[model samples]
Target chain A: MSGLRITTAAEGTTHRVVLTGELDHETAPELERTLARLPQAAGHRLVIDLSGLALCDSSGLTTFIVARERALAAGTGFELTAPPPPVSRMLRVTGLDRVLLARHPQDA
Target chain B: MSVAGHQVEEPEDREASFSALLEDSMEDLYDNAPCGYLSTLLDGEIAKVNATLLTWLGYRREDLVGRRSFADLLSVGGKLYHETHYAPMLRMHGEARELALDLVTADGHRLPVLVTATVKKNQDGDPLLVRITVFDARERRAYERELLRARREAERERERLQRLTSTLQRTLLPAELPEVLGLEIAAHYHAASSDQVGGDFYDVFPLDADRWGFFLGDVCGKGPQAAVLTSLTRYTLRAAAVHDTDPVAVLSTLNSVLRQRHDPGAPRFCTVVFGLLQPDGDDFAVSLASGGHPPPLVIRADGEVDVLTTPGGQLVGALPDAHFVATSARLTPGDVLVLYTDGLTEARRADGLMLGEDEERLPALAAGFAGTGARAVVDSLAEVLTAWADEPSDDTAILALGPRPPEAR
Candidate 1:
């Protein structure tokens, strides 16, 4: 029932986690646990595809930061692709997108 | 010799008694006056001060009569404030006028007080000594502090309430829009002012792989009552969609839910637009249901923006089984559909101009953003509103969903 999903792109080590649903106090911890499990990609990248995100709150923003930090410490690069515009703008203002790789266009 | 002696003695005795009475009255008046009484020498030395001020400060006269100057009884900051602010004013004025100050107590506490000093003059009209009066301001200071504390507490509570309301408000909307293949979703909610709560809401969710359910509504009021109705409307829409894909039936059920429980006498009302978004292999088909709400704005893949012309939707809960209007449209990749609350259209500028309703002005942003895609369109849409609503908006909310461009695939 958790809105978070983790799957490695089949051919590459690029771990792509697609986040769906609302991230609030109730569900943000679920993401923290999920992000902690992925393989340590020393040189590879982690892309969080947020195309499915409907609403983002403080808990959601914090979870992304935690995910980005974990990726950073692991020597893995963190990227967030396809953030819904509202979430994307919030990240921009909070300067989170600068830490995580953020591509505004959600499609590709 | 005896007569002269007796007469002289009587006058002397009379003079002595009268002088004694005069001295006693002076002491009594100085010690018990409503205001504090003190005299300082030219060098700022306390020569004599009354018992009234001593009592106000919980001090003994012996402690200050000759041992301490007036400045010794001031707090560190109060001392500095007096030196820099009060002293100059007092000196320049010859009588330091009513100056609010704090005098330290013997017990190491503070006394809020006001003091006024006047320079006494001799017969020659030369400055002789300074006499000061101290009035206890404990009651006034206490009252002012209490008022400040209450204001600060209320502000903190409002901020907490805004957060709580925002948290609850966010829950009322979809957490994440269901990712329909080849679709980009954009949403914005413009909080009016955090001072008070609002009833504006919007949402989009997945109904099926090829279809999605979305709506935007404005509840008529505020506070706990409106919040409860908002929750009911949101959950009912989500659950009712599962039971019926038809927008009208879903609204009908919502009307019944509102009618059954909520008091119509309280006059609760809401404007809502429910839509089922279906995508064909290459094109998208949308069916919309309206219940006394604003029409949805559609930006076509071809860069044309226009209001979807669905009208005559009845207010939900106003009447039992109120009729709702339904409409449809075809969507190609790059089509943007935006549903919003009246707050967006009704946003007023300081100049008193309002951003026209979606049906009128949405196309300006949509047309300009034709090639840029849904995210860009929504960004512009939100930006236009921000610029237009420089003043606080009542309760603006928007839900935008569009098909992804070929590159997004």
Candidate 2:
């Protein structure tokens, strides 16, 4: 069981990261610890590539929501891309797509 | 001679010794029974096990005593799950009871068993090694499988019953809308839920070609009684339309039939909108009679959307002479008339916000149509509804009549 490994890279003003393996109850704290260390830049966009994510329950979602709020408070753009079907569906069911400004804006 | 006389006393001693031997055998049963009995250190390691159990698993006392953990005995999936999820829970709660696991036997057969584990502690309530008990669950697994099969059969039976009811419910509506000249017409019904019956019904049939009679109604309550009223209203309207093309007179007859058939104590009433459409050359003129139903929505070719209010109309069957209000509209080319039940407006979102269909409805519809035909209108209406409702509605229905474009032929 591999814990979530977040690999970050800098592309000009945008901060891109990829999350891999399970994001769940006990392991969410580890993700938050990694998120807190990030430097905040005004208008910095955070694009999370979730293509390698295996599973995520409610705790993991709450972590993302909290992360999104922190980024938005600094007036920065935060968006996720390539979420697996399970995570994407959870976002849709919870109406996170509308709040987070996910892809396919017109449909939302 | 004296020693021979003491033989009875000797026999009593022998009986006492036999009882002592039985106690020794019982102690041996708990320690080295046919099944495994092992206690481990604070971290799972072989502490003690029955000789028979050791032989069955092909593990030596020296091989497992200080090295092998209980998790080591588990299959790969089970071991991984235990380390990631189960072990932590056990540490926090002091127990991991009746967890089903598979172990590799000496002959390489997967031995299925139910394991119960508990953490032992010292006087200071400190942690200790986990003590585990395993019970064979193959028979229980077979029993559970049988129960699952029975549950599936019961569910299938229920689905069949609902389908039959749905088919019977569908048969109670008109087969097709009568093709009224000089007008493009389309209608739809969106069921709030599939499991229960819906009383909302709509139809458009000719009161003799030139005059077309269309009715949309919601019978009070649900189930077979509402179904009965729906069937009665349709037949009575069809029969009365032949004699009287007047929309108000047609409803008056429906009122009488419902009043006569219903007992005074019974609750019987329905909201209906009956329209008489007549082609005046190339234009269409509609005279609508309403009985406590939502007024039709007119989406003009000019792209203006408004809810037509048909006030002062009484619900049918509730009054001796239900006062039906009559309103007239001249439908221009590219214009569409939508007569629907209140079900559409009343659908609740996840946040308990009722989707104000009349107000916020057009934007979604306008988006659905890239400025074109009735087909887009119908498709958009369904898409927006499924989006808003999220799931099948608690009680929602819609009926739209759109005019098609002339050029495509």
- What does fnat come to for each candidate? 0.00, 0.00
Instruction: List pairs with backbone clashes in candidate 1.
Output: A53-B176, A54-B175, A54-B176, A54-B177, A55-B175, A107-B408, B90-B96, B182-B404, B292-B313
Runs in model 2 lying further than 4 Å from the true structure: A1-108, B1-96, B101-113, B117-131, B135-147, B263-266, B303-308, B349-351, B356-388, B392-395, B402-409
lDDT of 2 by residue, B231-314 (tens): 888888888878887778888888898889655434366778888887765557888887767667667777776556556666
DockQ, each predicted model? 0.01, 0.01
Which CAPRI tier for candidate 2?
A: incorrect
Candidate 1 per-residue lDDT, tens place, A54-107, comes to: 656545655665566567768987888888765664444233454455655663
Candidate 1 lDDT: 0.74
Model 1 per-residue lDDT at B252: 87
